[model samples]
Target: MHVFLPDGKQLDLPEHATALDAARAIGPRLAQDALAATANGVLTDLVTPLPEGAEISLITKKNPGQAQSVFRHSLAHTMSQAVGEYYGRKGFPKEAVKRGVGPSIENGFYQDFDLPEPLREEDLPDIEAIMREIIGRNLDITRADVGKAAALEQFSYDPYKVELISELPEGEPITFYTQGEYVDLCRGPHFPSTGKLPTAFKLTSTSGAYWRGNEKNPILQRIYGVAFASQKELDEYLERLEEAKKRDHRKLGREMELFTIDPLVGKGLPLWLPNGTVLREELTRFLREQQFQRGYQGVITPNIGNLELYKVSGHYQNYSDSNFSPITVDDEQYMLKPMNCPHHVRIYAAKPRSYRDLPVRLAEFGTVYRYEQSGELNGLTRVRGFTQDDAHIFCRPDQLKTEFLNVLDLTVLVLKTFGMNDVRFRVGTRDEGGDKYVGSDENWTAAEAQIIEAVSEVGLPYSIEPGDAAFYGPKLDFVVRDVIGREWQLGTIQVDYNLPERFDISYTGEDGQEHRPVMIHRAPFGSLERFVGILIEHYGGDFPLWLAPRQIAIIPIADRHNPYAEELRAELHAAGLRAEVDDSSNRMNAKVRQAELSKIPVMLIVGDKEQEERAVSVRERTPEGHKERKGVGFDDLKAELLERYQTRA
Candidate 1:
């Protein structure tokens, strides 16, 4: 049989030969270094037989994906064996504990266990000692298949594994891996031995999780651990974790007295504090001004509407479970609006009839509610009552491409203004096996084609996500990576063919006939609250000059300089800048420190020397220090700060 290498070179080999065997044929050195292989771009164990005409590439320790998976999987087994030995040393039988599944996740691995008693936090160090001892033993690892009956007998003491064995489909292979006295049911291309694991692995934390993710099933104790291919990588990951914790939005929000979430009130309902409300309003006004410049008319609607409204829009049929239950009126049922699309559709359908009025864009910063599960609710990412920066464009069929391109331009503006340069897009398409979306296939094709063309014409970096579209139509989403490299979905633009049909929307055509106007749904910021939450963390509570709740903080070196500080504050306020004077009875150093902690973008220190000269000493927060000062005329300072504020970032 023939196979192709990554470089497009073809090689003849024995039919059904294993990847390891193919590696040996390539070169003795390659076979020695090959940890795994990717057959036709799909990662697989080296023991798996390669098919004819497949593209195979050997994976080594330098391959991040292969190296991390191999090390994390091995760490799980090592931790499991460590736990068993720890219990044995405490005079407990090995059979007293049963194991659940452990697998490599995105950043690490976790093993679940069914124990007689919950493992305490203090038990982790002892287990680590045992894991180190096992690593020092350097036991060789091997893999083999076993019969279902034999697997069940070997794991009889572990009901979890026995259950797993019983659930195996007929004629399916059950694989196992053994190292030292530990054996686990795993399909793996593990490292050659225990010594191959990085010495930098560490157990992170423990949590309770339901078996098989079913809440009704037995709760198992889960231990999470992280492993890296090198000590430098491990140290970097640990440092990032610490930085993430320090900049966690929930923690900073509290410290800055911004927002609060009370369990007694509700799980996902966040109450904005006075300071947070100021921030939210600033963002709303900012977007509102931009929308006005881009030809969007503001509109308002009620928070709750009749149930039939959503049913007609197809949201109630598909997303009913995620919404709040219908409110029982005296003789009818009404539902709290879970989305603004249905309401926006009603507005469009009200008194519309001309092609000249085509491409009508209506926008709203409307707040919607959802019933998010308690466990899924994070700070602002997942919330019940949050506002969306939503808008809908009603345009002629021929105008679809232009409208989509316009929306894309607006989304890019939002990203660039916030200094988020690493923005990528995803085009979501319909799933063939899923519902056909109760619209004509012709309409679906037209909408999908328009989206593809518009995105392609923009010449931006993007990918396609199959089966990720809305039920009504295909869409494109914008995602941005934060400072620590976590991707967040920030904006979306969707083309809908079903909504116009459902709402019976039509406009008079130039040929004197009624024609359906294609609808484009867009949210540039997704949500002001959520975006600000991400921004708070992304900037570490140090907002840009314009977006800061207090743009400038004026500090007076002595009580005598308070008048000069207040005078400067009044001038900035008159110029439409959010400026404040520090009137606190504290030392000059303390006042400056407080302003820095508050993250006021620009600080002006007024002493007798500066006050007499009608000037201010400026200190801007850069990644460098603040001791470096620049003196400028008060008028010049105001002009420069205003320019930065208007341009943002």
Candidate 2:
């Protein structure tokens, strides 16, 4: 048989030979170094038989991404073996532990097992030691296909495996792999021997999971582990993990008293506290003013809509799984609105538009709901109900590019104002030959080309990602890297040509004929709850002066000066600053400590000399230690502080 190399050279091999044979024909060293093979982009084991005229490329450690995935997959099997070994030494039978699927995940791998006893966090170290020993023994890894009846007999002890084999498609091969006294049902592209595997892996934690993700199945214990090609990468990842714990939004939200989820209210429903409300309102107010300046009219929509409304937009078909179930009032099915675009579409169709009103921009801070699983819900980032800084533009067909660029500029402005400097764009195009999307071919093509053209015109780097677009359109999504070097998907702009056609909306053209107007959907911050969560972590809870919920604290040195402290608070309040007086029985030091702990931007100290001189002692919080300016004139301090806060970071 003949096979083609990556450079388009042909290699002749014996008929029905494997990829390893092709590698050996190329060079002896390649065969020795080849851990896996990619034939025409299909990743497979070195021993897998190659098809004639296949495009073959050897995957070694030099192929970082593919090699790491293969290694991680094998590591899951190794961990499963170690678990069985550890249990055997504890006087349990070999069949006492049954294994479920073991798959490679982002940054790591996990294995699900049904064991005789529940595993504790402390048991991981000993099991991990057993894994090391298994690797040291240098066991050869081999794969083979077996008949369905034979495979069922071999895995009779594991009902999970039995069910898996029974579910395989007819006429499909059932494959399995083996190591020293340990065999598993797997289709693998693994290292030739355990000795070739890297030891830079650690089992981090354990949790309970169902056989699959379904709640009706028996619970299995899942062990999570992370691996990398080198120890340096592993160490860096561990450091980032530790820092992430310190900057966790959940912890900070509770400590800072920003937002809370009350069980009585419901899970995944966050109730913004007074402090959190101020932070949320500031963001909304800023976006609203920006929209107003950009010629956007504000609008409000109902929280629930008729089921037929969503059915028309096709969101009912695409999002029904994640969306809340409909409620029946007077035998009518009313759905909690899952998207703001459908409502905005109705608004555009409400009034007859002309070509002169080419671009009708409508904006809203609309709250929407989705039925997220309890397990998937996090603090604020993943919630059941949240508000989006959403807007839609109905423009003439010829104005699509201009409207898309305008929305892109507004999104960039929002990110830049938040100090998110490291932002990149990803253009999400439709997946080829996919049926999940709804749109005509010509519309999809035009929409995607316009988005790409607009992004390219901006002269910023962007990547084209297939299967990332919405059901109705192609989108440009902003990925922002935070201070901790973690990326978050923040702002997005989508050009949609399907919604207008579905809703049958149109505007009169210059030719005195009606024409369909294209729709541009944008949200600077994807959602208020999620954006605040990312912002909290990005800033590490030390918000800038302008965004600070409590901008200033006024502390009295003694109870006798309480009256004067109240006067300062009133003055700051009248100046449009959020200020409070610390007139409680706490000492001066306690008062200052309390203010600093709250992350207040400024603290004014009232003393006898300051009161007599009509001045005040000022202390400001900065990234560094406190900056103090003593005995400043109260009038001067107010002017300087107001200017500083107004300047904003």
Candidate of highest TM-score: 2
Predictions in order: lDDT: 0.85, 0.90
* Per-residue alpha-carbon lDDT of candidate 1 for residues 1-649, written as tens digits (9 for 90 to 100): 8888999998788887877787888998887777777888777656767888999988875664556776788888899989888878888898987999999877788999988678987778778888999989988777888998889899988889988999999779999999988899988867767875778877888988888877678889999988887778788988888888888999989877789999888888889997788788878888888889989999998889899999999888888668899988988899988889999999988896799998899999898988876556789878988899999999998888988898899889888887788988998987787773668778878878888888888788778887888888889999998887777998999999889999899999999999988999999899877897898888888777777777788999888999999999999999999889998999988988898888877889988889878899998886465644656789998898888878764
Deviating ranges (above 4 Å) for candidate 2? 4-10, 16-19, 22-31, 41-43, 59-66, 624-626
Off by over 4 Å in 1: 1-16, 25-28, 62-67, 120-129, 147-168, 214-219, 435-441, 627-632
RMSD of each: 2.9, 2.3
Question: Pick by lDDT: which candidate is best?
Answer: 2
Backbone clash pairs in model 1 (N, Cα, C under 3 Å; residues 3+ apart or in different chains), count: 0
RMSD of 1: 2.9
Q: Could you tell me every candidate's TM-score relative to the true structure?
A: 0.91, 0.94
Query: lDDT by residue for model 2 over 1-649, one digit each (tens)?
Result: 8999889999989998887898789889988877888888988777778888999888875764577878888899999999999999999999999999999888889999999998899999998899999999989888888999999999999999999999998779888889899999988877777877889899999988888887779889999999988888899999988988988989988988899999999999999999999999989988988898989999999999999999999999999788899899999999999999999999988889999987999999999999887777899999999999999999987888888888888889899988899998899999988787887999999999999899899897999999999999999999999988899999999999999999999999999999999999999999999999999998788888889888889999999998998998889889988889998999999999999888888899999999898788999888787899899999888887788766655
